[model samples]
Target: AVPEAADVDFSDVAGGAWLMDHIPWTEASHRIGALNATAEIARVLRIAMGEAVLSVERHTWRLNEGVTQVWQYFPADLYHLSARFTPNQGPHDQQAETHQQARPTDSQGG
Candidate 1:
């Protein structure tokens, strides 16, 4: 259950928008990879094996409380992802920030 959403009414705006507006921003983690469709992915996305896909999983949290988890899949040939980072200038414990780019994958690969 979403403990953070205990008393929230999501009748006006979209649920996602409400979550973004109401929940405090904390941190998110992402995992991305190119893979063949798994059974679950095939059922949801109607994809087949040998059909390469780009999978992205993200989990977000507010301090120690888990907020949301999401997974997105795209045909590998139709998209590309790239990220660039500048060295962290903040405290040693903080992570470096990343700038991301998304475009069509080339014939060779992403």
Candidate 2:
């Protein structure tokens, strides 16, 4: 990717952006993309139900109310639930069968 732009001389290029003369400007865009992926991984680890929120305020500029809003992964609730639960519908069928067994008998002694 870097090499493609390296071949194009600034004078040969159509645009007149000041930073276009420097290669680091192109590199900076790539750097930002890499950081975004890392940030997403960090985000997933810290999320819980009803915890994430975005508060944007408009003043002199569209400022981020809390730029450092980050989360840590809490697997305790999910881990325990997964460990105790089986991935089958057999339990539901068994529960219905139990209800049938517990029905009141009319012939029982009063």
Candidate 3:
């Protein structure tokens, strides 16, 4: 289930940055903890991709442009996670093109 918008907090950007910087990347537990922490951050920000608000996609938390006062969420944490999690890497352009093709067209031609 998606987390509620109110339940998500995006105020820990600095803390998350510190954790990402200090954690020993070689430790498996640390990596997992970082992932969990990222998830927690997502929970707080109420990120949602495509249609569902608050649903995390490919380990990314999507946020509205202006909802959170913060300009960026967990910049360091997300960078570290991206380097550590191969699957979390974003889809290539080809895959994105295919997905776009499959999406139902909107009446307004969106």
Model 1 lowest lDDT segment of ten: 92-101
Per-model RMSD to reference: 6.3, 23.8, 15.3
**Tens digit of per-residue lDDT, candidate 2, span 31-106:** 1011122445446645444443232222211132211222333323222111233457464343211011222336
TM-score of 1: 0.60
Q: Point out the higher-scoring one by TM-score: 1 or 2.
A: 1
On residues 2-105, what C-alpha lDDT tens digit does candidate 3 reach at each position?
32434535585554344344331222211122222345555654433222222222221223222122223332222322222355566332221111123345
Residue 76, candidate 3: alpha-carbon lDDT: 26
Sorted on lDDT, highest at the top, how do the candidates line up?
1, 3, 2
Model 2 RMSD to the real structure?
23.8
lDDT by residue for model 1 (17-66), tens: 87778885488888887888878777676557657888889888888788
TM-score per candidate, chains pooled? 0.60, 0.13, 0.17
CA lDDT for candidate 2: 0.31
List runs of model 3 lying over 4 Å from the truth: 1-16, 28-105, 108-110
Q: Runs in model 2 with CA error above 4 Å?
A: 15-110
